[model samples]
Target: MVDAAQKEQLIFVTQKSLRMNRKKHFSESRCLQLFAEILTVDSGLKPAFLFDYCLSNAEQIQEYVQELQQTGLLSENLHILSMQENVLIINLNRIIQHLERALQENGVQVIDVSVHRENPQLAETWVTKQVRAQVDIIWKHLKSQVIQTGESKPGLVTASEIFSSEWNLCTMFGFLLGFPASYWFDFNTSFENCLSMTPLRAFSVSAFCPRITKNLKHRMYSFSVPDILYLDLQSAIKTWQRELQSDFQTQTMFSHLCVSTESVCLSAVML
Candidate 1:
């Protein structure tokens, strides 16, 4: 009983709605692909990562998290430390335990020149002292912040609280994220690092993560270290790669992830 013009208008509207739905679906799926890469945290390859919540709507974020949980991509050990601003800082609740295990198992030598540079006599014991001192400092800082914010427990601290602390935010995150050679500097004197004009290499690991959607492939994590330290950190880097590969083989979420790494020469002052 419908006229030709009326029928044409209805069909056009239906097609437009379908197109809009597809676009939304694609956008959410893309976000999932990138976000799900943080499953590396749960796998113990890394301790934490930052997720950008601004990339998707709240509903989409909820659904993405739900899907990850349902599929075990986001495990019980992993938790969001701060849901502030655009970036959500995700980390393990038992961070100290994780860091201790990573340090012991990977044969990573923790060295902090900042600790022993002032007192050269302490060089021999500095490495051991530095590890415990740094961990204690970070733990105490986090505990105080969590208590003040009432976020959760000592494990669930906020970014804003971390920023308010005396320690450098980037340095703290670098350690928490399990980078072998995190740059250390005196924040009181100046936040500037000595990497100016120095040759640097950007290291990135990427994978075709299909937990959310088959079409998504992108870099999971990236960081830069001084070219000079490449040799010193080579062992740690290899251990990290091996652990990632082990995860790819054993973890259900990382099946077919196809993780790979690339290094490129780059120069930057304020990394």
Candidate 2:
């Protein structure tokens, strides 16, 4: 690591060249110039940008001629490089917490902003003083064992420290906020609570996230990414039978993939 006195930074990365349309992409070069502009404004926070080797544009060797023209938009104080190959870098934490703020700003519906709206005095502390204290506790418990381990590390605390403590703590906040982070934070990325009509209301009991009961993996032949496999129903019976014996719910789910008199399976070979 650099001297402890050195500033920490968020990094912006640029692809040397776009492989899909090398000539056209190299000619336009708008993406690279825009990237340099993002770094220029981050001077107060001291974020950096780095270029990788193997020369294409920088890696694809298109050329950095246009990148050089944008000198005013690049900052020397915010640039950094690392020599150690083993070092790992996280560009930036979500850096954006406070999901409800975005929803409110964008005029999207928010379930609740917290009772803090009713009492301004409780703004930073939110629901309770005790929960704020738990933030440090959770951080210690989390770091005592495993995250980016094997070295003496500094304590890591992301903004979501409030909900990270324990399940009950989050559940408490969930009811208090009228909706937890689950219902709003990037809701579209997860289909877990598909059945629970969130923000509107939720099931009183736990909502089991639905998963692919049948991705038909057996119909998949040994593979790599994007490998094509021919489906043969003959092989799917074992999986179907296994599910049929497990429980009523699973059996009901898998029943369509089976037939009593002529049970079938499927197979595939990567093409």
Candidate 3:
């Protein structure tokens, strides 16, 4: 019922549709692969993962995250906090537990109250206030309801439920990320950081595949240490590198990718 020209047009259209579908599949697969790598790295070393680059839109992220969950790549306790500006994946239990540890270990301070300071009490007061403020911010959002049982117990609250503002989220995340020395400031009082003008040395590690697809040759992981503190933290950084190499070698998904680290000096403000 069709002429030769019409049949050729139909075949061309079918081929084009197939190509488009294939391209879409590759893109979605790449995104998922990247996310899986993040999960694997964070599961062992960090309580949260802050993705600096925008990989996919919100809708796609939700869909991909769900797929990841179904495939057992994402754990039930881990949550996706935000997908707007950047992707924030957090382990709710770990964050809460870390906060408790900070409270217990520091007593009245986490950064330490200097003995040589002109006002040691003043420093202690400020440090305690800042730490408690962060604790309050997290608890305020996780409100408890009284039931007929008459006893109050905490419920499992996701980070997305507890944090509405990005600033507050950042405040909480700073503690849970497991940096050797995390800077803490009261977000309610000020957003300024003590390391504002300092130089930050960023160590970036990536899983590289030379023969991989053009769009996805590298999956990177990076964190920064203040340049002044690098000497004290060099051993910690070495430990991290060793762990990364071990993970890359043991994980079957990363079998094709070789891990490498690159260090560079960056301005603190740029982060």
Candidate 2 backbone overlaps, count: 17
TM-score for model 3? 0.50
**RMSD in Å for candidate 1, one decimal?**
10.1
TM-score of each: 0.60, 0.20, 0.50
Model 1 residue 76 CA deviation (Å) reads 2.6
Candidate 1, residues 12-121, lDDT tens digits: the string is: 33233222343443343434444555555655555666654245433344344444454333444334444223243344444555456554564334433243243111
| Clashes by residue pair, model 1 | none
Query: Which of the numbered candidates is closest to the native, going by highest TM-score?
Result: 1
**What are the per-model numbers of colliding residue pairs?**
0, 17, 0
Instruction: Output the lDDT of residue 26, model 2.
Output: 28
Against the hidden true structure, what lDDT does model 3 obtain? Answer: 0.45
Tell me which of candidates 1 and 3 scores higher on lDDT.
1
For model 3, give the 10-residue run with minimal summed lDDT.
141-150
Better of 1 and 2 by TM-score: 1
What is the C-alpha lDDT profile of model 2 across 181-261, one tens digit per residue?
211111224222211211111112111111122222111001111101112222332332343234224321112222223
Model 2: how large is the Cα RMSD against the reference?
Answer: 23.3
Write candidate 3's Cα lDDT for 1-271 as tens digits.
2244543443333232222343442344434344545554334434556654344534444444444454444443445555236556555555445455555555222332132322112234655576567665653332221121124223221334334453444434545454434444445555544554445665555443322233444445545655655676566556546655654665443334443434554333422
